[model samples]
Target: MKYKAERDCKTYLDTGRLFAPSSKSCHVGLNQVGSLPLEVRSWTCSNCKIKHDRNVNSAIIIGDEGLGLLALGTSTYCP
Candidate 1:
């Protein structure tokens, strides 16, 4: 038997831009430089100056990317 495993979007640009937890109000994505360490659970966006939860932000990014891929007709399964 053969099996295939699905994966979540895990690629973060080395520029760290992907790590940016965008500000909901301004919709700005900024590199989370020096942030998101193991102990850090949240951060404030420099653009909009809004605080964001790290986990929640990460989830949002992953979801968005997954949706984007779907919209592109790249994947039929929802990641």
Candidate 2:
């Protein structure tokens, strides 16, 4: 017998845009940071054991609280 496990995954564009049918040019948390190296796709937080995508982690940092001061254009200021 053959068996396979299915996992849910979503792909984002190189520009950090979500691959949703209705997605716009909004800057998601993943886009602000950049792409993840092929080898370091996932990492565990030093303090927390939380597993995070390298790309997504960086984006979160870029969009962290108090980051509004560094806003560049509409991409950063978009509500």
Candidate 3:
């Protein structure tokens, strides 16, 4: 995974704009600002009011970033 991440960060000659399709607005994280010891493993987005798991959100962000980079044409694939 680390190797893939590093590879994605590289710059590509094509320079085509890349964007990650995300549903982040639907899961804007918990609204409890100072609350500690979160009772649930998941929370609803204040903006869209959609429920989301902490782990799932993290994975989405990471995958989005990777895909964003890939779309930029910085892929390390030597084909």
Candidate 4:
């Protein structure tokens, strides 16, 4: 999934220093630095007040995991 700040003045916040593993699904993980809490399905940034998409964020995490070395090298198919 692609992340695009709603406004040109706004920028994405990165919270993760490195790859973060998924707590539930092996095929999912988060790569972006700063992210919203799991309890928060959606939120407006304190600074920008722009609505954030939770599904988009989760999709990005899963996409990152899919591109990882292990996922790409594994013969097991994932869909």
What is candidate 2's TM-score against the reference?
Answer: 0.35
Tens digit of per-residue lDDT, candidate 2, span 1-79: 0122112232111323342211111133222223334575665543445667655655654454224433432232212
- Candidate 3, residue 46: how far the Cα is off, in Å: 0.5
Cα lDDT over the full model 3:
0.51
Any idea how many clashes model 4 has?
6
**Better candidate number, 2 or 4, judged by TM-score:** 2
Give stretches of model 2 more than 4 Å off: 1-38, 65-79
lDDT of 3 at 3: 62
Ranking by TM-score: 1, 3, 2, 4
Could you say which candidate leads in TM-score? 1
- Model 3 misses residue 75 by how many Å? 0.5
Q: Best candidate per lDDT, number?
A: 1
**Candidate 3 stretches greater than 4 Å from native:** 2-40
Model 2, C-alpha of 5: deviation from truth (Å): 43
Candidate 1 vs candidate 2, TM-score winner? 1
User: Which residue runs of candidate 4 sit more than 4 Å off their true CA positions?
Assistant: 1-39, 44-51, 70-72, 76-79
Q: CA lDDT of each candidate?
A: 0.52, 0.37, 0.51, 0.44
Provide TM-scores for the models: 0.55, 0.35, 0.50, 0.32
Candidate 1, residue 75: CA error in Å? Answer: 2.7
Task: Give the poorly placed runs of model 1, Cα more than 4 Å off.
Answer: 1-30, 77-79
